[model samples]
Target: MRTEISADKVKGDFLEKVEELSGQSIWACYQCGCCSSGCPVAEEMDLLPNQVIRYVQLGLEEELLSSKTIWLCASCFQCFSRCPRGIDISKIMDALRQMAMEGGVDRFGPVEISPSELAKAPQQVLVTVVRKLSA
Candidate 1:
């Protein structure tokens, strides 16, 4: 289970976008894995919270957007509070969700909600579903 990370492919603008949109510097993350350690759901994530920051730092926009990790985030803010660098992992998750939405839902993983079910769901629930499932 080896993963190859190409720093050469890191997009400057993508990194900038994460910082600019989220108002949090991705470079601030030192990859100490504190965020991941604090994440209660990290065990269920395809990529840990710390890994998400690494993806942003490396400008791996496509990889970040395609990952199920961002969608699995509980947004409990536990990781954010525990981050030694004070990085807002939750905000980064939101930024990733926004990017996914901008790319269109198809760029994300498969979703199995029927139109009728979605229509019948509450507004906030629908919004959360779309936000999380969009990626």
Candidate 2:
């Protein structure tokens, strides 16, 4: 989707808090798109890693929280390693996901899963979902 955000429209304070919580500075990102280019799942995301950083910088909390990218992220740190500024983009995604869950998005949805279905899920997926939702 095409979008526009002016500097005055950005929320400086929220950006500061994200940095404080994640130990990664939003200001450090230069919008170089390196993070997005390097992200393995970037093509599958509604918003690329670089765009997510911009949303965080602009304090688009609701948009960021609702994005599919937050769930699609593998947290493999490929973007972090590729970043020229060394920003931990995965951590930021994690933080946004935590916020989303806290904002009432169900991790497993409203429908109750059968015990057999739950048992069939991969152990790693279960652990990751639990960790992200609990954060």
Candidate 3:
């Protein structure tokens, strides 16, 4: 993806909002790759944990917010456990998910699925999806 980064973008409100919501210093991450290395679902993510943090740091709001990595996070805390900076990546992911949902970016909902598919879906999976994806 070709993104144009500027000083204004790096100092934008989105970065402040993310820091406020997640309560983590976005600049604290040194990109040691520990978080990504320990992430069990890293392969499935569009952006790894460290890459997500870098995106936030660079104020790539559109790309970061639209990423599937935020929603795909399992909140297993594996990334946090491995982070040398003690940054909880799961919390950041949660904040990103919240921001995305608030912005009306629905990843999953009744409209996206067929009735037959919804009917065949596991009850637990449906419940989890509703809890996570619903605004």
Candidate 4:
């Protein structure tokens, strides 16, 4: 929650890195809720798609990188389809995931899970987990 925004933070390297990685204009988003509204996994996300863009614009690297929302994105492109600015939220999420992994903020790995838990997980869940880890 509580984040301190300063001029330096607004113009930090984090913002540039995200933009470069995602290849999207982070400032193009104007807080419109269309991306969040159309996100299929919005209910499962800690931060909505639009909020993630806002965080990037503000250069809140720690908060953005730590969010589960980035990992939750399914890259279905629903947000991109609905965005008035044609922003592809999935690319942004991918960039954030990359940044988080670079910072050693991995959620978990298959090696860390018990065999019993792994067996209990659905096939789709396991596949997604493996995909995220590999990415």
C-alpha-based local distance difference test score of model 3: 0.88
lDDT of 3 by residue, 50-78 (tens): 99999999999999988879988988999
Worst-scoring 10-residue span by lDDT in model 4: 126-135
- Winner on TM-score between 2 and 4 is 4
Candidate with more favorable, higher lDDT: 1 or 4: 4
Scored against the true structure, residue 6 in model 4 reaches a CA lDDT of: 84
Candidate 4 structure quality by residue, lDDT tens digits, 43-101 = 89898888899888888988998788988888889889988898888899989898888
Candidate 1 Cα outliers beyond 4 Å, as residue runs: 1-8, 106-135
What's the lDDT for all of these models? Answer: 0.80, 0.79, 0.88, 0.85
Give lDDT: candidate 2, residue 68. Answer: 88
- Report the CA-based lDDT of candidate 2 relative to the real structure: 0.79
Q: Give the TM-score ranking, best first.
A: 3, 4, 2, 1
- Tell me which of candidates 2 and 3 scores higher on lDDT: 3
Q: List the residue pairs that clash in candidate 3.
A: none
With candidate 1 superimposed using the best TM-score fit, by how many Å does residue 72's alpha carbon deviate from the native?
0.7
- Residue-level lDDT for 29 in candidate 2: 85
| Model 1, residue 102: C-alpha shift (Å) | 0.4
After superposing candidate 4, which stretches have Cα over 4 Å from the reference?
112-128
Query: How well is each residue in 1-135 modelled by candidate 1, as lDDT tens digits?
Result: 334567565746888888877899888888899888878998889888988988787778788888888778868999888888888989998888888878884433325667787678788876766656554
Per-candidate TM-scores read: 0.76, 0.80, 0.85, 0.83
Q: 12 in model 4: Cα distance from truth in Å?
A: 0.8
